[model samples]
Target: MMNSPVETIFYIIDETATILQEELSCTYLEAVAETGENLFQDDILQDEVSEVTKKRLQKSYEEANIGEQPNETIRKAFQFAILKGMKENVQPNHQMTPDSLGLFISFLVNKFITTEKQLTVLDPAIGTGNLLTTVLNQMANSNVHSIGVEIDEVLIKLAYVGANLQKHQLELFNQDSLEPLFIDPVDLVLSDLPIGYYPNDVRAQDYELQAKEGHSFAHHLFIEQSIKHTKGGGYLFFIVPNGLFESTQSQQLHEYLHKEVHIQGMLQLPTSLFKNEKAGKSILILQKKKEGIKPPKEILLATLPSLMKQSAVEDILAKIDGWIKQNK
Candidate 1:
């Protein structure tokens, strides 16, 4: 038994993840990922358990004392634990997007993703769902819908808990995003595309990317897929590693993007933006091309300093708003 709900939630998640990993004979990351799927039955509630994994998951949830009531604080604790666990226990190569930057990107992207009906947002790599949730909350509209697909099991589960507690509806999937058969095209797409190369399997082959064999980064492949899944004239805002631009293999992708989409904006984020100082980041805002649409004469390009204050971000958003109006 734990003293507080926060402590209990964290302990249960950690212990369960570790136990599952040991039992399944996989990495700790794989175990953490499986924990979420095991807990949730229908993507919303914790009922409908599979017989094999039910005992372990039930014991953890019961120990945590997650009652019928949706405790917002507890849900937040769950999300925090997931983020913390990934940072401390997982390989140093993996990183979660910081909340400050997530909020900044969400608010900045919100201005351009407007719709008469509800705004539909899709995040291809919605680790823990913080970025998507933040974006939705800031939109200040009740009619918005968010869809996220993540490969990380634990992160997706934590994201589901957060959305449920906040009373927000979301479509989340714990599967390989590179697989065929995509969700309906959405009004806007937002994500922190994971960095690194993917095995050139059938899914990679299906993308038919212009890059040579073994050169495809998961981020670039997701960029292509996200563009394909976005409606014509819809917007996509993703954080990508800056090194991608300088790679020779990326030239083919650059050419394809030039032919297919409008480069609305690019922000060179400081290397210090993430915990890993060696990893440089940049924001890419692209608008899918409609049949008769032409690329804008001027694309907004700016560099953000290492330490950006909220006021400075507001100023940037103002400029982006002006650009959107001019282009529209």
Candidate 2:
């Protein structure tokens, strides 16, 4: 049987990356980024690799014909390669958002912003760029400008090469997202918030959501940063901890949200998606406060059924659609 497009492309990515990994003495993810860049440029840019290895890589690239594949095919293929690399050397912060959740977020984004013909989207903690690209792929409008901020060098490189491979024209910044960003207000902000304490106390002090003492929660600072970069009344979608509002600093977060944004919805993700119940998270929809816009008459709250159950998921989505039609 012929290989599926995703399998074929993933095989090419894995094969080329393995060869590069052996040649460069680098980590699997680093080699994967190099492989993706080589594919995007249609040339073996690594001079360190032997002539034999270069020839092998070129053959794989030619056979794969990555440019002819659909954008989602390329994205998924690269995503598989990234997942493989993560398994080889796992970093807690290097995780990519699951495709199912990314797709659902895309649906919410489309429903909320149907009137906008052109939009700018920002992902403050872009990581592998999977979530942002997935959302972009599902959006109805093609005229979108995207910006991704990531602090890790290897992850950002992977994101960059992945964007090139998928032909997504996004601007990426390789720096701490908590620091000042030299970007204009964007139409939408999407992030899977990085959960941890931020080490930079001075920088944390700059954010309204910063903790009162000691190290601040990085996720809280990220929410404030994302909101700051979003235009008034623009939407911010976050994958947050289920207990996001139950922390010691919850009062401050509540105050900040009350002052700056209107809670649009909260959808508790299925516990089955995580390793355990404590690790489960939810999708939070917030719209930045503006002069005329008011809170939804009733927040769109739902506990999502397992994404594996298509009919149940669709039924819940239909209810969500009804809510959107009535409120949006």
Candidate 3:
């Protein structure tokens, strides 16, 4: 029996990446990035690798035909490769948002922005571009302009390669996301926000959510930056910690949200998604303030069932649909 498209693509990626890793004496993830770039360009760009290894890589690439695979299939295969690479060199911020959660967020984005014919979306913490591309693939609007920002060079390189492989024209910036963005305000913003204190106290001072006397929460600053880059009445969806509003600096966050945006909803993700209860997170929905826009009559709130339970997930989605219809 023939291997499925996802498995085939993943095999090609892994095989070529391993060959590159051995030849270049580089890490698995770096080799994966190189492999993805080669796939996208449809040529081996590396001169350092031996001719023997190059011929092996060329042979592997020729065996797999990924040109006809669906975008999601390609994305999923690349995601699996990235997940494997991450395990080999575990970094705290190198996590990819799970596929189920990415799909859930995509649903919300499509439902909320149904009326728009064109859209621009931004992801400030676009690690490897997995979550951003996932949402982009599911967007109702075909005419979308997307931007992604990440500070790490390797991660951004991976994101660039993945976006190219998926045929997404993403405007990716490799810089500290909190630094001033040169782009115009976008229609929507999304992020699986990086948690923990931002080390640069001086840069943190520029944000309204900055702590009065210490390093500010990176997640809090991300929310502020996302809002800043969003057009008035535009929407922002964030995957945030469950205790986002209960932190020691919650008051500042509360005050900031009250003044600049309207809290549209909060849906606690299934506890089963996390390693422990303490690590669980929620999807936070917010809309930037505008002169005519009003808060939803009732903020949509619910704890999602385990995504593995298909029937329970459908029921929750139905309830959400009803809420959206009534509110709209």
> TM-score of each candidate?
0.75, 0.98, 0.98
Candidate 2 Cα outliers beyond 4 Å, as residue runs: none
**Model 1 lowest lDDT segment of ten:** 40-49
After the best TM-score superposition of candidate 1, give how far the Cα of residue 92 lies from its true spot, in angstroms. Answer: 5.5
Off by over 4 Å in 1: 1-76, 92-94, 275-277, 306-311
**What TM-score does structure 1 among the candidates reach?**
0.75
lDDT of 1 by residue, 127-201 (tens): 777777777766766487889898766567667766765556799988888776368998889988887787755
Global CA lDDT of candidate 2, please?
Answer: 0.93
State residue 265's C-alpha deviation in candidate 2, in Å: 0.2
lDDT of 3 by residue, 1-328 (tens): 9888899899999989998998889999999999988888879999998888889888888776666778898898889999999998999989999999999999999888887878889999999999999988887457888999999998999999988887887899899999999999999999999999999999999999999887899999999999999999899999999999999889999999999999989999999999999999999999999998988999999999999999999999999999999887
Ranking by lDDT: 2, 3, 1
The TM-score obtained by model 2 is 0.98
Candidate achieving the largest lDDT? 2
